[model samples]
Target: MTPSHPPISGASSRRLGFLLAAGAAVLFSAKAILAKFQFRYGLDALDVMALRMGLALPLFALLAVRESRRAAAPLQARDRALILVLGVLGYYLSSLLDFWGLQYVPVSLERLILFLNPTFVLLLGVVLFKRRVARREWVALAVSYAGVALVFVESLRLEGDHLALGGALVLGAALAYALYLALSGELIHRVGPLRLVAYAMLVSTAVTAIHYVIARDPAGLLRLSAPVYGLALVNAVLCTFAPVTMTMAAVARIGSGAAAQLSALGPVSLLFLRGWLLGESVSALQVLGTAVVLCGVLLLARPAANSVPLDPIDDPLPGQAGNPPGR
Candidate 1:
């Protein structure tokens, strides 16, 4: 495949792109809800992580093989090393922190915290690369954090106790992912998005498996209820694997900017899903906070009039600028 394809102009193509992008966002956001569900069955964060990634390992391995064969050239030594580092930071560490945070926080708050990756990426650019921050971008960050604050306060009031720890853990997850995004720009260009994602996921899967073996009883997996295994399968396939593929395909059909715009649906969908499936009530404060965060993030996401069109391979998922297509 080429770096860029001809613009897909038909209404049907565009509509399919919209549906794919929207559905991918919802599916990605639903991971938190799935984790919360597993928690009710006495599964800890590592238990869920082990089950989810273990179940998904074979699929990820196949993706790695498929993308490797499709690559323009074989990966160099440096590229292999970078994949190891990024796989750890982007998927392993970030995902561990996120899963642990879910043990403490509500799904709504967890989704909102993860949704702040765009802002974290912005700040990382300024701090690490000496990139200039536009004034509007600062305002956007402020607005976004203020909204998070509102929800944080509301969550604290209701959930109490472990809210602070959970919020911190999720925030750390967002920051670690931001680091991955900040550093992965050149690698994505050289390796191709799908290839990079597949290889990186394979690396993470290996690390996660080792961690599970060292810290957990592998035999415990067999004792889990059928429902737990069923949910793990759904979470691994529907939430993780399917969304990555669907979002990338959506980016190919539409443009990245347009596809990213649809990502705002993620948190919104999670909010309703939590209420309907988990019986968690939606509060007015949570609603207002969500609106404000969406406004701020969308403001950052708006493309400049003279901006170069983003490559479909550059941004495989929504919710962040140049997000590298894995949950």
Candidate 2:
């Protein structure tokens, strides 16, 4: 049921954005699982990113080539410069940092730290747009933040130095990711989601490849035959392509800050999915933690900024961002 809160200036748009963001989270959750699969098969973290991006590059390019036709004029010099920076920061550099940090930190703690992205996004909105969050949004934010803190404290208590480092790296990932969404939100208005993601992924993949060319061992990449390749493909398709596309689409609908708030679901989904897939038993605390985070999602979904005047549900336009791509 829709909450009592009055919707924002654009209720329908915000609702549209929220669903797409959650859809993105479902796909984005696979990142950890696929990375774990690669590690299990003996591929180093860098090698895994390298192989995954190598495959991802062409697919991104194919879309980009098609989307570029939408532009009325050649990309301005400033946009090209921004694209370069965004490509390096959003995907290659930040992702590599996450990989390195994961080596040092505990898994759950890293997720908790990464959850700070919403906070970052909020802070950026305040600073950049003078956008003030409403009371309900604040409450939802608190619940989400509190949930993350509890999980992190519990996770760290059971950890090592590597896990600790992972926590720091994940924090950086959150910051970079926040920057990506905030900036990309503005840029999407200019470039459109499809072209932006396509170009960004293509450039980011090329940038990642340069690192692999310098130090990667070809034998290491080839060691794991079919399973590893399949996992890498899964990582690229689900983790990178699918979610990022939704995120961009969400940005197009609602502002990126709202979308970022919903992004708190990623780690929560990861915990459950990881536990279920690996057959790892979840303790009471973890389940409680997941519930706490979910409460935050339901609260945020209450339609704080926009007013929903329609029926129980609003039918979205075709090719909507939240649905599976091309649906």
Candidate 2, run of 10 with poorest lDDT: 315-324
lDDT by residue (130-222, candidate 1, tens digit) is 666667778888998999999999889988899999999999999989888877877887887778888888888899989988997889999
lDDT (Cα, tens digit) per residue for candidate 2, span 1-327: 122222245778778778987878666655766776677666666877787788777778888988998776678888888888878877887777776666655444455555545456555665775665666667767887787667666666655345556766777876776666556654655776678768877778888878877876556676668988888888887777777677766766765445555565666677777677755445667667766865764465444532323332221111121121211
List where candidate 2 sits over 4 angstroms from the true fold: 1-23, 104-112, 127-141, 244-265, 296-327
How much is 308 displaced in model 2, in angstroms?
19
Candidate 1: segments with Cα more than 4 A from true spot: 1-7, 305-319, 322-324
In angstroms, give how far residue 294 of model 2 lies from its true place: 4.0
lDDT of 2 at 164: 54
The prediction achieving the highest TM-score against the true structure is: 1
> Against the hidden true structure, what lDDT does model 2 obtain?
0.63
